[model samples]
Target: MNDLGFTDEEIERYARHITLPQVGGIGQRKLINSKVLVIGAGGLGSPLLLYLAAAGVGTIGIIDDDKVELSNLQRQIIHTNDNIKIHKTDSAKKAILDINPNVNVITYKERFSFKNAEDIVSKFDIVADGSDNFGTRFLANDVCYLKNKTLVSAAILRFEGQISSYSAHKGSNCCYRCLWPEPPPKGLIASCGEAGVFGALAGSIGSIQAIEVLKEILGIGHSLNNYLVIFDTLSSEMRKVKINKDNNCKLCGSKPTITSITNHKDYR
Candidate 1:
């Protein structure tokens, strides 16, 4: 092993990354020492977890209170026929380990909610939010902002998907709440299940999420903190829209109302 502590096998495994000027030895090491938490193990989470582990993220935490259903197999590539009826977190962990045995996979067979938001979120350097519900998404944004962690969030419905990174805790960056002040009325937005998502759309968007997470870890290239990316599979088009921080936002505004998880809990 060299001074960076990369084994010969690791060097060989990540030779492509090491050869890149932007992500050389140091960047690969950064990736090998990073901790990332994925908030779901379904469509988006499936590909996101696989890419992260393959890229050598040191520790990965997966929290999902879901069972691997036959329907999930259509989009959740990380699971197989045998995984159906088992906990999604367990199935995902097995997949991650299969991809990279060196990765430390931590599985939480539970939902992401206010009760354990901070406790779980604070443990990771960054969070990838692939949750399908508004409650969990909002909670992740709030907790990530409160804990001063970078959050890369993505969602897919029908033939479209949207992704953005939130770092409002950092300079001039906007939090998720700035984009949608609060969760829409329960029945207003139909979920992927209800609306029927394009199976391949999840992989397309999830791969981008994985790229953003790596960029954040390596501190290389531009960050998506103030920009939102929307992808339309039907037209094969992708658009990046600029978003500005809202001063009146409850979470990250100057007169912020959400300073802690407790504040978020009370407001919710």
Candidate 2:
């Protein structure tokens, strides 16, 4: 093995990454040793998992209960037509291995729930949230915050997408609740089924989310912790705005009200 402990095959596979002055042998080794848990295998999860696996993240855990549907194929590019009806985790695992067999993939064909969330989340070094609904989004964010794991969260609807990374473990920065105190009302909630997301928007936002996760693991470049990136495909405009951790933010605030996961009611 090389000094970085990379096998001959691994060295060749990650040559592009190792060539960068910003990410030499050390950063490549860091990437090969990182463990990341991605919350969904849908649109956003598709590109996130693909990129991370190709980047040589040593271990990746994917959780998704749904089966591959015809509707999912358009944006969830990780699954193929032959894999339709298969569990998303299984299909995703297959796709990730296809990209990089050296990267170990752990799959959970289950939904994120109070009983299992903490246990599942604690197993990974970081979490990338690509869940579609508000309930899962809030649940993932809250659990990551409570578990003190770095969280890279992203969402897309229609032609727009947004992403942010959060870590209350380091210092006072924004958690998902800081940007959104709680899930929206049932009547106000929107879905891709209703609003319709651009097919490419998921790739655009999810790919960046992958970058955020790598940056967090490598401790390179600026972190997106207190920043939110908004992308508008229709207008071809992108905006990055600063946010803050609400002292009253039920979850990570100074006077925190959401001391436990159950306290933040899931409106879904």
For lDDT, the strongest prediction is 1
- lDDT against true structure, model 1: 0.92
List the candidate 1 regions with Cα displacement exceeding 4 Å: 263-268
Looking at model 2, residue 79 earns an lDDT score of: 92
Per-residue accuracy of model 1 over 153-245 as CA lDDT, tens digit each: 999999999999999999989999999999887788898888998999999999999999999999999999999999999999999999999
TM-score of candidate 1 versus the correct structure, residues matched by position = 0.97
lDDT per model, in order? 0.92, 0.90
Local error of candidate 1 at residue 45 (angstroms): 0.4
Q: List TM-scores for all candidates, in order.
A: 0.97, 0.97
Clash number by candidate, in order: 0, 0
